[model samples]
Target chain A: MSAALKLVDAPRRSVALEVRGVSHAFDLGGKHLPVLDNIDLSVAPGEFVALLGPSGCGKSTLLRLVAGLEQPDVGALLEDGAPITAPDPSRILVFQDPTLFPWRTVWKNVAVGLEARGLLPAHKQRVADALSLVRLEAFAQAYPHQLSGGMAQRAALARALVNDPHLLLLDEPLGKLDSLTRLAMQNELVSLWQKVGFTALLVTHDVEEALLLADRVIVLSDRPARIVTEFLIDKPRPRRRDDADLVHLRQTILATLGPVHD
Target chain B: MSDIAQGGAVRTVASVPIWRDGVAAAAAWFVAAIVTVATPDVVPWGSTPLWAEILTGGAVLLLVLSGTVQWLGRVGRVVVHYGPWLVALGVWFAVWEVVTAKTGWLPKPFFSPPQGLLHVYLVDTTRLGLCVLFSLRLWAYGFGSGVIAGFLVGVALGWSKRFAYWGMPILKLIGPVPATAWIPCTFFILPTTFSASVFLVALASGIPVAILTASGVGSVNRAFYDVARTLGASERFLVWRVAVPASLPHVFVGLFMGLYYSFAVLVVAEMLGAKYGLGWYLQFQTGYSAYANVYATLVIMALLTSGLVKLLFVTRDRVLSWQKGII
Candidate 1:
């Protein structure tokens, strides 16, 4: 908690990101499977946007491109008008799986980025605060196997958050949680976003989640995904689950998902 | 109803300390002591039948130990719990004595009584001690160098695609052949008999370790690497921290196999050329028809192997305790 407070007291350091004419495909053996069309998007500093898409759509591919893990076949990803040629600690991505190093305790997993960058000695307290932010300070010494699904996701979130990242790329982070935990995590995520104020681009299949937390939800079409539509939510904080407007928007979005392929 | 209640009260007498566990163990040893003293040797007593004295002495010791079992702490308590096995051991000794020495059902020239083996240990202590020290030194150097080289090569094979492509084919080709097959070439290739013996032991131990370690490293989930990479881990960190740690269970499996193979190779290699090892002592005793000394050396070798195996198990449990609940 002290580290987060100290970080807040320091000057803001979040950077803006821009994705221009980005298109991507993956090589499956000798075959090329096109996943992302030439899509353009931009995220402002401190903005929270959700990329909502169908299951096999190219939402995750787009996130990876912006993360610099994969380069787009065409066009480029720029952060603050500079090209992202490699993965940097300034931008971090949290995958659907917690992906916690099983041999490490929760504290060590959160400290991994700091240790890798050779900054552990100067910023040890930040690991504690990151765990505290996830309400898992009590479990800092515990292994990932000891934690429940929701707790593991929280630890993953803390791992990204500890970098004090300018841009946080979330790839369906809460997808594996039970429905009750999912609802609770949705609220926790919104509150954490409000507190830290990092620019978040969440890729999720949950329509209601986007409506509840995201400032703007960009829905993509099927495979070779193109941006089909976007909805801007201007709701007040503490939005209720049973809010009429949210239910109406959810119905409209579900209809847009189309009929099941099966 | 009152009569039944009185019957239940009478059943509590079964808890009497007179009928406790140590009683049976003590009784069995007493019977063994009496048998040892009374039995007449069918063959002329070699070296004064020292076993009867040892048996009497052992019975006395067990009685004292069992009496003070409470003072033995946790280990003593466990020993007392296994009192029945001790009782069985006493009975087995008596039966073996009656069959071999007393009745001569199994005669000498091939089999010797327990006293004959004990007499060898009592008279040849210094020479046997030297042989043990020499064997241990050779084993330590051979197994140590073997495992270290194998582990490094395994890591390279598992981590690098190019290395695996070239090295794996050779490893697979040479792996199935037994270490003893290399003895002829090793004797000519190395300068000394000891060096040749060491090479044999190293080859026997190193192959399994290298093969298993490569497979273990190769089978690690690719997702772990991706996770570490995104966490800003350098290439070196990914190989050492992620790949190596994740593949440890397999490495341990390799180590165990390698340990057994090395022990087998050690005995064979010592027999072929070494001058001062337990294997050499066994061969020398056999040539002199001193079967007693051969049996004594075999017992020593068995104990050494088991002790080393127990130590390895302890180390594994400590390092891999993270797999406790899951495994």
Candidate 2:
């Protein structure tokens, strides 16, 4: 028990995530701005869930709560039946921005999780492996600025994947890419998730994207976000973008995200 | 914008052989020779005929130096680039020598010929070398400690709100005041004049670094911290690894400010107390109306400061090489 905290490992450990009645608010100077209200979500192990919502609907806030970067004002987030009170290497978040440390090379950025945990010396090969996984072994020595937008995001993905995270919280990780790059990355992400089998909670506003990639899509209400509606995607792997089933589901999800009607 | 365009034109011209160095350097040598050999000293205010011979020798040396440009190393390349400036310098020197030593247009005791300054170097090399050594020691001790401590404090203030709450107001208050303003109190607090001088220099250089470092650390994109935190960074790792590296550019800016301030304070401190430094030499020479010595010391100071600044620039370029399109 005493030596448990200091033990070393970088092996994959996929786990379930549960968010129970989580509510959160921020104090901007003196004003109280509510962001999330009574959010209840449960993700099964190895599930890929896409969260779709209206703009400014606290999608990022909910992701932050799950990543353990912030504590909810009320309720709790659990991973594998254990409450998450603080950030751990087991659960990593990839932000909308690549957020690659500008001073470090792509390889070093990928090594950050292991370096932070003092496991870098033993697991150096993992950094190279992660870069190879993103097909960026050619760019290991390159800085973030030296890379294009698509490459930079790929490096960010490598940085997250290097940790062998149990849960990957993606906050619109592909939001800033051009259309062609976004399409390519969407496919790459689906394939990587399939291989790694980590439970994924992706936050995105693209309705078709959610339908194409996610096993389930959950929509949220506008600011002070609450779970509004959800859809179960039962299609087989490698679903086509122009497929009739996806087209119909995208329309439904878009309507749910569109303006409210009395 | 026009200046950059002009630089582009000049760069293209630089590819030519004669335009790069030969024509301009030859012109400089010709002008310098004409002024030195043809003219006679007027109303000799204790002027040396030997200086004219030396100027003639310099003209011949320039011709030889220009011819060997292709064979000379890095310094040779620099001479080629600044060939026009060298010609202008020759013209300026001719005007100076004629006005000061030959015609005596500028009055005595206030101005000097270039050779007059050179004479100080030739005669007083030992004393000047000692002063140089002392000044270097003082600067090394003061600026080195100041930068290291200030950087750590700046990181702390930027990283933790509680640290900032206690430190920021005090830093802001102390930052604006000149380092020399504390001279009276510094003398009483420190045991020796040397330590007192070091404190002043340290204070001068440390403040800018601290302020700039704080701002740099504090202004880092919060997303970086979020990512690092989720990767299981401890507080120590966040500070030393994340905050320090992110804030380095700002810290360097501070280091530059401190370097200048410490030098300014260093000179003033030497003027005040028991010291063998360039500042003391300047003060001592000025007291005796040795304008030549003062000018020589000023030249040394300029060269030293510029060299140090270049070194700092090289280090910054290496460390922040990841930053894009800065130059």
Q: Relative to the unseen true structure, what is the C-alpha lDDT of residue B232 in candidate 2, on a scale of 0 to 100?
A: 89
Off by over 4 Å in 2: A1-12, A260-262, B1-27, B30-54, B71-76
**lDDT (Cα, tens digit) per residue for candidate 2, span B188-230:** 8999999999888888888898899999999988888888999
Q: Candidate 1, overall lDDT?
A: 0.84
Where does candidate 2 clash, by residue pair? B205-B258
Question: Would you list the clashing residue pairs of candidate 1?
Answer: none
Instruction: Tell how far residue B142 is off in model 2, in angstroms.
Output: 1.5
Predicted complex 2: CAPRI docking category: medium
Measured with C-alpha atoms, the lDDT of residue A104 in candidate 1 is 83
